[model samples]
Target: MKWTIYQLLVMIGVTFFMWGMENINNENLIAQPPGEWTAVNSPLLTFLATGLLITGFYFIFLFEVKKKKNRFQHPVWIYMPQLCMAIGGVSFVLFLIGGTIGPLGGWVEQMRSLLYLILAYFLFLIFLFIFSFEHKRNRSAQATEKTIHLTFFWTLMLFFGLFFLF
Candidate 1:
């Protein structure tokens, strides 16, 4: 993929923005004892960090994925694991959110504790549905003829659906 000056500048700006958000999140470490400002627990900083990271990903997607023909760009087994890390990062954030909010109340609040699991199941379902649809549509962007088997994929989806619904 070709990089441009604009993209580079945007990237640099995002990096700085993320760093500043981190400092905001960890302002306690920046502040010292004796008449100094300490960290304030601001929800805004966390939200801004979330927004910036997502914006960065979308920026990358527009330049890298959407612009390319056959956006898969690599074989599933080779590429998916790396993409999983990004997915995992989001999951971790959701986990943190759920964990933090889970203790605020009782049984209804208990749902917060399982938020990640619930989300993961839906995410898996949607991902599989898209994959299956793409396969049926012959949208396999891979160079080779082989792709992930639909049977195994659907089986996983079925399990998640059963667990989620029943």
Candidate 2:
């Protein structure tokens, strides 16, 4: 079954939704009391998770652009997702740096929260990107696209949820 670009985009959108939901829930869990939930105390793990999430989104953007035959040139807004990913990555790195320096508790936590919010915006961009890219597509490809989209979405959410929640 040949897949239309729209079908692929829908799959991506569904993925973003699923991932965002998981992320929100996970973040909530992490914000809970320390004794009740085993928070990730290791800075290395925090940094790694943030880096990987940013990297994964970046790859997704690159792959979509390449797959679309450079059609991304149409509008300037199309690049927003990649930009958000970059911002999140930078913010996370800054949080890591601040955390290591000591006496920067306020700065580190602020940076971390900012990064999380930006990551949420990135998910919105992902949704838009998929919608814009999938204006016209065949139905036959929808099933496969849906499966992959859901898989990636849930996987990302689970990974981030685990990292953020406990």
Q: CA lDDT, every prediction?
A: 0.47, 0.50
Which residue runs of candidate 2 sit more than 4 Å off their true CA positions? 1-40, 75-166
- Give one digit per residue, the lDDT tens place, for model 2 in 97-154: 7657754577536545544545545554444444333422322445324533553555
Among all windows of 10 consecutive residues in model 1, the one with the lowest summed lDDT is: 143-152
Pairs with steric clashes in candidate 1:
none
Instruction: Identify the runs in model 1 with alpha carbons over 4 angstroms from their true place.
Output: 1-4, 22-40, 66-71, 77-166
Best by TM-score: 1
TM-score of each: 0.37, 0.29
lDDT of 1 by residue, 1-166 (tens): 3644545766787667645644553454533457755454443443444445444533543444334464445456344544655666686676567557754235325444243234434444444344444444554454212333442344445544654574
Query: In candidate 2, how many clashes are counted?
Result: 1
